[model samples]
Target chain A: MAAEVEVVKNKQVLLKDYVTGFPKESDVIISTENTISLKVPENSSGVLVKNLYLSCDPFMRGLMRKPAPNSRTPLPAYKPASPIYGFVVAKVVDSSHPKFKKDDLVWGLAGWEEYSLITETDLLFKIEHTDVPLSYYTGILGLAGITAYGGFYEVCNPKKGEKVFVSAASGAVGQLVGQFAKLTGCYVVGSAGSKEKVDLLKNKFGFDGAFNYKEEHDLDAALKRHFPQGIDIYFENVGGKMLDAVLLNMNMFGRIAVCGMISQYNLDEPEGVKNLMWLIHKRINMRGYSAAEYYPHYTKFLDLVLPHIREKKITYVEDIAEGLESVPAALAGLFSGRNVGKQVIVVARE
Target chain B: MAAEVEVVKNKQVLLKDYVTGFPKESDVIISTENTISLKVPENSSGVLVKNLYLSCDPFMRGLMRKPAPNSRTPLPAYKPASPIYGFVVAKVVDSSHPKFKKDDLVWGLAGWEEYSLITETDLLFKIEHTDVPLSYYTGILGLAGITAYGGFYEVCNPKKGEKVFVSAASGAVGQLVGQFAKLTGCYVVGSAGSKEKVDLLKNKFGFDGAFNYKEEHDLDAALKRHFPQGIDIYFENVGGKMLDAVLLNMNMFGRIAVCGMISQYNLDEPEGVKNLMWLIHKRINMRGYSAAEYYPHYTKFLDLVLPHIREKKITYVEDIAEGLESVPAALAGLFSGRNVGKQVIVVARE
Candidate 1:
């Protein structure tokens, strides 16, 4: 038998227990007790990855809750005391896998830890272009970019001069959807939680109109004020009252691309959408989709967005926390609209 | 003016006033005061017809309510103390229009009376296939047929062996949608108000399962009992709480084609659907459309269903009243689920 390889301490963010109502930062625990053998085992074809950047995505909230009895979700809950996982930009520290070599850069699903032993095939994509900031692999050049591109062009089917409204406009996916709508010659409006984010949407993101929902007493009146002509396309992020208001103001034959429902994720009972009758009167299509469905179109998505990004015609903003221990707070803040842009964290550096 | 134009009494159903809640028979008046000339004006390109049968549709309730202060409907409210209009089967008494002449048979939007002078050029469809019962023109062969064909085939986008659920499953449109799904080799379930309608759906229309929703206190459990694998297509007719329940049982990538919400039309505040979060979880598409959108495809639709009707491969049922004076009760009964099948009333024999 070969001599045992050197082991190193691995810091991780672990789930404390199953969540109810809103998840608290205390639901996750940062631990430094775990250790890992940094070298790949001779019999395994897996790669040992050092997580460089980990994302705080809204969908991650689902993993903290106990799923409803008799219903099945696409993914399962994170085991108690186990490391939570999400989209990550990583460096392959060691590998026995045919597709990856030591020090190769990649982006895909990984654990919220200092390192991960990834054995699943097709779970990771080799980072192809390295000219841009590597952290972008956590968002714009990855999941967020593909989502906004596919959702706007394929699902909502926007046309020139259409009125597009995006909720959570400063979030990872919302910002890109607004920019994509603009590139398609649309009139865009966005809503966020704070005045600063609202200002970022209008002045920095080039939105035609922006409003802080927290300051507005009536969401319907605010939507009416921003969308005098009614919304032609609604990119849904925050659900509940915002969705109900958007439904009331959708134009004839409108489309709503439902990407996420950050507002409703933490609630014991999500608020009801009351104005769906407008769905019939206006002839709308409200579609819900997973970003994975568009993963196959990554090259096509890059072809459309990469050029505009290179010319500085399209821009992205990210709000990142530092270190692996920061994951819990950064993730919990998403439900409360605490982040200014795409929420991500730098876990480590090469 | 050359001769005193011959005129006759045209007994009609007239709206008493804009309705506030559940419409009553008292909300309409049977009037003998209306008179019509026996001929079309010489200068006009229009037809004067004696109405034979008029359809009692759920959508007619919209015409009863004065629209919201901030909104507009495609059609306006029925004028107080004036004749109401609907889909009608008629005999042309006189015509200056090139498409019709004396003794021509037709079906179109016409006044609920003994006679209608129709000036809208494209409103009428000349009855070309006379082999079937003429009353079929009021239900299966007219707007209901077109609505079912287009909504099921175009909107739901079903494939063989998929599961389908239709609400208000014994009504004019729902019956046809069920039969269409059966003919397409899909497993279908339906919900109706009465046991008689439920029996008709399963034994007559060949639906795989049928349930009286009024008897089921837990719609979600009822749906699960019928569709353990979850619903693939939901043809929404009765909205409100039923819609909320259906949302719970819909399969991933399921499609909901919204037709009418008879249960909601009379409600001052329609029930809010709370399970919309399932839309994101299941990746569903809920689309709402109008029957008018399918009118241009009448010929294509006829080509598909006409042969089935000839071969007795498809069947339709009607709950018809005997005279024009019965129109108010028959139409009002639709909202209460009082009619067993398609509701139609005879206005004249010839």
Candidate 2:
């Protein structure tokens, strides 16, 4: 006996076309014409999910562009008139896959629409710990969390008493990296775009020092002032002039873990970095990494960070936008620094 | 009774003043005004050596400049009116230091003069194997040898069948790095400034592909032509635009070991690198290192390379400058890409 299929309106934020420079709200369209089935089709290996949360990450800017020929970008590009997708927290409505089932809480690659039929279950993760806010699954407990773990703990390999500096502090991963550095017993300083964010970095993230980068005319002088003894580790989020300044103040054998270069993502021509020669003079090690590469460490990362979150040893801040329709403004706001901490959009509460 | 101290005329290449940019022969003065004895002074643990071979290395340009305030450059600056010094192959004439003795051959840091009283014998290494040409000590057995060994083997960590690229490919360290990549079972390409050096890279260094970077309008396109699969490892001897181009053509998880940035050394304001954002996309690991730091691996490096030299499996080219008088021109010529190979100034044959 066959059962009647349940269909519902699936509101989405669709990409109009590939972005050239800075993305705008006009680049995305709010569409409600699509209807999605709540059931996974018979004999099909797919999971039907109700999107609960969608992340507004800086890396999304890359996905909005048409990839160059022979480009090796690990993430897939968005297709025109299709719902843009990224790391998301969703509730499984139904599943034909063995790993996921109905009512299962999960977080991973999903669409920005109200409902998504995820075909690749490999990118999905079944959420285990739900005591702390489920909204965290969109950020600190998801890709952003493991990114800080891999880039800082694995790449930078910070040691106790080492001096650490983080640019774009108070943002999703930067905020986490600062907290991680503090937990590692390193003296850490962070630079943010706003005084309010700087305050959050020092007060909320427990950074040893914090500064508003917008007020400083000389980035190099700013770094020198905060890092008088020279920085031993740099968690690079913003690139360009800030990266150049950090290079000048880097200690010998210092490490720079480049998780993102948000500053150059929108430029027609990315800004040139002038101080890379210092890498040789100071024997610095600088590496770039994506958090998805560290998914294998999710369980281990959870074991370490979950307890810290509960014990108040570490904390996370998120700026959430209500409803799926808000994604156009929310995603565009990321480049303009309109949101604080992790920028996330809510499609549903549960 | 003290033994007779036989004083002799000591010719030196002295720095007239700290250079501002693009060193000219006039910046360095040839002076024969000094005289030195063949014996170490009383109560001093110094070693006196008659310079046989003086290495004309690119790093010397950094020392010729007045170092920036609070700069973390590991190399010391050359004082005005003082004889500049660098790695040299010499015969120990006399020594009060326990490690060195009269007539024993050595290679290490020494003055750019006929005879030098070297107080820092710690930097010196006794010449153990004399079967190879003594001139080889100025290059293949000295800092240039280890610079290539460390930057390629220790830093780049090349895997078999990987693609490798060397910038400034016909220079001292770059020549060796290309050969080392070939020895490691890697496909190697080299970029030089002139057609003659490009021929040397292919014919002498056994590079799979050689291109005159000066002839290429777009370095990125040139790299793409040579490295269709993209570069897995880069031995970065020349920074600036070369580094930027290499970044564009790097494969995922590529490693770049920057031993020197010869192109940027003489610039008042070093050229800006525009493609650093690719570092993030490609997940590249770029590190800088000085061969001196890898002195501990000198013996292991020798054991591996000596046999290759003996079996003619590897070869070295030397651009021999005839006398101390030729140094002013030789040192300045390095900036203008005048030297075809490892430049060595011969003060004495034996």
Candidate 3:
């Protein structure tokens, strides 16, 4: 005995084609030809959501490239002229799943559109805390937070007084990791592409030291100057030459938690890691991890971080591009280092 | 009172010069000019030992090269006309240390000479349980064994039914790793340079499968064929191209225990690992370890491996060259894949 649901226009940012190199705003088209019902279909098990915020991450660039022949990750290719998918914060408008209900706010993977039919409800986590800004779920309170937590604590096993280094320091995960390192009483240094981000890392994020990598001609000398002894933990966000330099400066028994290799994503071929021999020479441990595998620890992470957020012990910086039409430009800006902190698109605010 | 021990001529293998590129037999010179006293110097905490077996490992090649300006490990440059140093099995002729006594059979770092005055007796481990072949101290029951045990069990954290892959399968560490993988109830594949080694890996070492990497035109294709479901554990003994290929074939959450990079040891410029990006894509854990770090686990490793050795569940192969005169050729042969198994120089027979 339910009333027939209203149908509405669904505006989406669609990929014009699979990108070759660095992506441009012109490569995506904002389309409003599609429509979606406001209610779940008869006998359907999916939840219908109104997308609010979408994340613009550097990893998204890798998705735009044609997958390698032997690529193990079988992430679905973006169909020409179809809406692409990424991490999204949404409101459940209609639901047939037992775990989710109407009007519940949740965060997980969804399409780059105003409305989405999420067939896979398992990945979606219902947002319980409403005191914080809802858009925080797009970055600091969601995947990026989990990534920083797991990569720094679990993978690196960081210790107090350890020398920690982070690349792409003002990005979503990097900014959080620097703060976490400080909380653990570790001496941390961060490298960013610009002076403003470097200043933000030192002044706002509370990192012990910060540097503009673009200004340093010799990364090895720069690292040597910053870490005279050597780096104990390296949160590797940018790969290629940065990784090569980090390898040379790593201390014995050092740990490198590989989160995302943003520098290598847009390249036709990844830059070779030349000094990997140091891995053997110094007895270093380098591990690569994805936030998806850490979903089980999400509640634990929330408990640890939420109190810090509420007490003002921790802070998150966001760079938001308003509306669905700005999605392409926001995503493209990630590669150019335009966004200062977490790049988010405010698709449709509740 | 002990009589003043007489000095005797010590036949030695001397380095002609700090080597560049692949080493040659002429790179080392046989010198009989050196002499050693049979007694430890009065009040000196040292052990005087007669060398019996000298181990020629791939790491020695790195020692021949001039150290890089920023090299972390400052191994002393091999002085011309002076005997080089490596792992050696020797009988203590005289001892001033409480832990070591006269006539104790021990193995540790020593000069490539007939007799050595070991100032640092701490590294020497007294050979207990002499029921096994004394020469076994050079390879199977020594550093090679410890490397395999710690790298596979501690570093790799191998699980039953996992798919394991090993490079340089016929060499000292790789041979042991393959056997240990089998003991763990894992599916194991190995790559060697020659067909004889390949056959030995399958028939003698009981590997599930093995291939001659030299014969295989495409290493990735070969790995794909052997590890159709992808590799869960990679015992990385040979780095460079093999490492690159293994990265492509690694399964999600795969562990790579890097024991050595024998292939890149002689190169002026080490080959770049191009597919390291797959490390992030697959959530792989690659760790580099050395036997030196696992000294604390020596007893535990012996407890696990000794039973297998006594029960004939495990076996070792040694390609031995007789006398100090043959040491140079034996060491040089390692680069050309001339040695079938563990390359040992039989300085003297007990």
Candidate 4:
């Protein structure tokens, strides 16, 4: 096995080139010739990690676009000829940093390769609780988890008995938000892209109601039917026309937490929401936030959510593909809604 | 003098046959005979008051629209044949209710006529802190003042050294927000419709910078020039294209308090904001609120602002029309940006 590993070297999938429109599998390529040493560099201030699981998220589509004139987070965050990177659960194979030791399980930004060398020490967090599956760190325990927690609690400021609606209910962050809202004593409903996801939301996540957005001819009517009292808090994972429809149906003083606009990200023109005037009329509070800002609550979150996972009070699902070669398809699957729950690529076995 | 008094019975105006587009002076007609005695019915639990002053706001333009399916406010709030009622400073001539009494000055919703009978006791607040001019209650001492205070301080959560850009600088609410932002140690800038208002913002209201929005060909560039560091708090009094421009110039985690959308109120088709996607990129917070909702804060606001008004620390501007006959033109002026500061109709002198 070591001989075969030595012959093949470390494989990586490059950006190939910056993307346009909907990103195709051809936009990124798997190249096997990239090399990495098993040992950490002498006098280095970096951690050498063996990437085990890589996360696929909708935000990567924005990264694929070359920095436009008005772009804030630039293309340099994902340069061409460099390996693609995202949230990944990894093992510290060797560490030159004093804080981490060999075999320490960590999760953060890592490359789409068998191995990665990271210089940004602050971004890396050492994993502590492992009662849940380690692959969950790539999702429910990592960025996606924090996103659901912060966007729902912090941004929406949910009150008990408030009606909450989540778009993309079967997706990684949306599923967790529905559960969190339920725990908060709020009535929660969710909209998904498929029948399977709709069922999962109601049966597995215990969402108050679930609807397939594709099957619903009128989103406004669908929301009204599901939420007769009107929605107080909207966890906005899907934007575009759904946002417009939701705006029309929102109750007075509604709070909209826009974690991401997945529905609009890959579109050619990105749909325009005509009903924004409703925001003014209804006195809605709409805010967009990133999860990275809520790191202070991570410990408290672990304390609350870990127990739920242990007692089977909460559940998480993942669509995982094996090998670094499957990374491209795993990410592409996110856009098409082909993968239910969180999609993760397993680069190596323990 | 008794015959003149009988001939000069206080009048009210009706919008002429539901006009569309920008309001004109010809849209309203006045009749002195329309008003009844300034008294609540016998044994009734309503408070009847003499409307000493009537408020003319940009929002009234929306009320003038023929009732639509999606109307936010109640229909009787703006009856066509009856006198239009809004925020007014009045003197309780007689009361059948426990909360108010004869000669008590109050700030509340009132008809455009010389008197109004209000059964809704919750809406009226007995005017306190009379050390300031009673007319001040019609402007900086009343609804506009509290709207600015709550929206800027509570909704925006403004920080010291934050950059605050207020649209419609010299208008009723905008003028107060600039002062409040300054009081909070924020650097304030404002956009007005005319050069005089621009000068008034900087010289009178103490805004750090002010611009005539009408003169600026490109509003985004105007915002950039004034707020070189990007705006942290945007007091949005004018929506449509101005809002789109402001979105592009917002800093990360910026807050926009939507007080009113004066620009789009009269249009058949409200303009769409194209750059809304920036809300996600910039992590902006946009919230809309009305002064009525912040009734709990009225005493707190009065206690803070009254002293400032009495001491001349906070100066208010009023465009007063001497008689009810001038009320139509005064109200119409709000939409065209003709009224600088608060537009008020003074029906009588003390």
- Chain B only, TM-score of each candidate: 0.98, 0.98, 0.98, 0.94
Taken in order, the candidates have interface RMSDs of 0.9, 1.0, 1.4, 2.0
True contacts kept of 1: 0.73
| Model 1, total clashes | 0
Q: Chain B, candidate 3: TM?
A: 0.98
lDDT of 1 by residue, B1-350 (tens): 39788899989889999997898988998999988899897787799999998899888998998767867777767889999998999999999998898999999898888988999958799998988888999999999999898889999999999999999999999999999999999999999999899999989999899999989999989999999998999999988899999998999899999998888889888777788888888999999998888999999888888899999999999998999879778977988889999998987777
lDDT of 3 by residue, B1-350 (tens): 87867999999988999998889999999998888889988978899999999998888888888777766583566778788998899999999889999999999989999999999765789999799988888898888988898899999999999999999998988899999999999999999999899999999999999999998889999999999999999999889889999998899999999888888888888788888878888999999988888888888888988999999999788898898899888989999889999999998986
Per-residue C-alpha lDDT of model 3 across residues A1-350, encoded as one tens digit per residue: 87768999999989899898778888888998999999888878999999999988777787787666756464676778889999999999999999999999999989999999999887798999999999999988998999999999999998999999999989999999999999999999999999999989989999999999999999999999999999999999999999999999999999999998888877888888888888988899999988887889999999999999999888899999899989878888898888999999998889
Segments of candidate 1 deviating more than 4 angstroms: A1-4, B42-44
Error of 2 at B209 (Å): 1.4
Docking class of 2: high
Error of 4 at B320 (Å): 1.8
True-contact fraction in model 2 equals 0.80
**What TM-score would each prediction reach against the true structure?**
0.97, 0.98, 0.98, 0.93
Q: Please write out the lDDT profile of model 1 over residues A203-301, one tens digit for every residue.
A: 888999999999999999999998889999999988888999998999999999999888888888878877888888889999998888898999888
Summarize candidate 4's per-residue lDDT along A129-189 as a digit string, tens digits.
8777999998889889989989998999999999999999889999999999998999999
- A242, model 1: CA deviation in Å? 1.7
- What does the lDDT read for residue A172 in candidate 1? 94
Please state the error at residue B292 of candidate 1 in Å: 1.1
lDDT of 2 by residue, A235-254 (tens): 99999999999998999899
Weakest 10 consecutive residues of candidate 4 chain A by summed lDDT: A1-10
